[model samples]
Target: MKKQLSKIIKLILLTCLIFTSMITQPATADIASGAKIFEIHCAGCHENGGNIVRRGKTLKKKALKKYGMDSLEAISAIVTNGKNNMSAYKDRLTTEQIQDVSAYVLEQAEKDWR
Candidate 1:
């Protein structure tokens, strides 16, 4: 009985470890699709991460940090809800697309848009 109980406890602990690792893994966004989406939808005013409509509000790393739009969540929220002159894409793009684009924007910003 003691051996059986120990085996069961070990199995449960191993299962919990696997479950925790799976849930804690970071989500990967589709960067290539995000680039394409940005070109089609956001390039008119934000070509190369430069905001033509609002020069100070560019997507470059510094500008994004200054405006508190540096994170994926922040960018995603703006894309989904829209702010000021920016149009909301929630009606036009799917949630996954939005997350991808947000990831792309942050990646580009980190690279200083090359």
Candidate 2:
């Protein structure tokens, strides 16, 4: 009985460790799609994270910082709504596309900027 209980305890601990690692893993977004979207839509105003004096601000992580929303969802909403001087993209882009692009933006921005 004692040996059986010890084995069970070890199994439980091992299971918990695996679960923890899976949840803590960093999930990233697609860069190629994001780059395509930026080029076709946003690059004219902001290129290589530079020359965006008129378009309000760069879509980089730092620009999104003012809204206090860093998650993929928040960025998606902002893109659809077109905050401030930015034009709304709701009619232009699909929901899934927005989400994908948002995730891509986060993935790139964090790696390249913040």
Candidate 3:
């Protein structure tokens, strides 16, 4: 009976560990798909993170920070809903795609679009 209890305890601990690991793992956005989407849809106006239509509203780090768009949530919202001259992409892109693109934009902005 003691041996059976020990085995059960070990199984429970192992299950807990697995569950914890899964729960604690961070969700990552697909940057590659984001790059492709950007290339196809955004590059014309925002090549290399520079905004052609609105020079002051570029996607560079400084512009993003100055405009309060440095976070993924802000960027994702803008991309999803559009702002000012920017066209809304909700009909053209999925939520996952928007997330991926937003992550990609942030990553690029962080890198100064180099």
Candidate 4:
């Protein structure tokens, strides 16, 4: 009875460990797809993260933070609805593609457009 109880306890602990690892694992995003989308849609004005049309509205971290667009949701909204000089991409891109591009923009912003 004692040996059986010990085996059961070990099995429970191992199960918990496996679950914890699975939950903690980081999920990867499709940055390359986002890059392609950006190239097709945003590169004309934002080449190399440089905003020629609007110098202060570059994709760099400072510009994003200054314009209250430092998060993925904010960027996604802008992409979905469009703002000021930018045209809405809601009809052109699917919801998932918008999300992917938003994620990519945030990732690139963090990397300083490198």
Q: On residues 22-114, what C-alpha lDDT tens digit does candidate 3 reach at each position? A: 986536899999999999989999999999999999999999999999998899899999999999999999999998999999999999999
| Residue 29, model 4: Cα distance from true site in angstroms | 4.0
- Give the TM-score of each candidate: 0.79, 0.61, 0.77, 0.73
Off by over 4 Å in 1: 1-26
Q: What is the Cα-based lDDT of residue 44 in candidate 4?
A: 92
lDDT of 3 at 3: 100
lDDT of 1 by residue, 2-110 (tens): 9999999999999999999998664789999999999999999999999888889999999999989998889999999999999999999999999999999999998
Clash number for model 1?
A: 0
Worst 10 residues of 3 by lDDT: 21-30
Identify the superior model by TM-score, candidate 2 or candidate 4: 4
User: Residue 111 error for model 2, in Å?
Assistant: 1.2
Q: lDDT of all the models against the reference?
A: 0.94, 0.72, 0.94, 0.88
Best by TM-score: 1
Residue-level lDDT tens digits of model 4 in 1-114: 999999999999999999999986534557888899999998898888888887888989999999999987799899999999988999999887888788889898899988
Q: Which has the better TM-score: candidate 1, or candidate 4?
A: 1
What ranges in model 2 sit over 4 Å off? Answer: 1-30, 54-56
Q: Give me the runs in candidate 4 sitting further than 4 Å from their true place.
A: 1-28
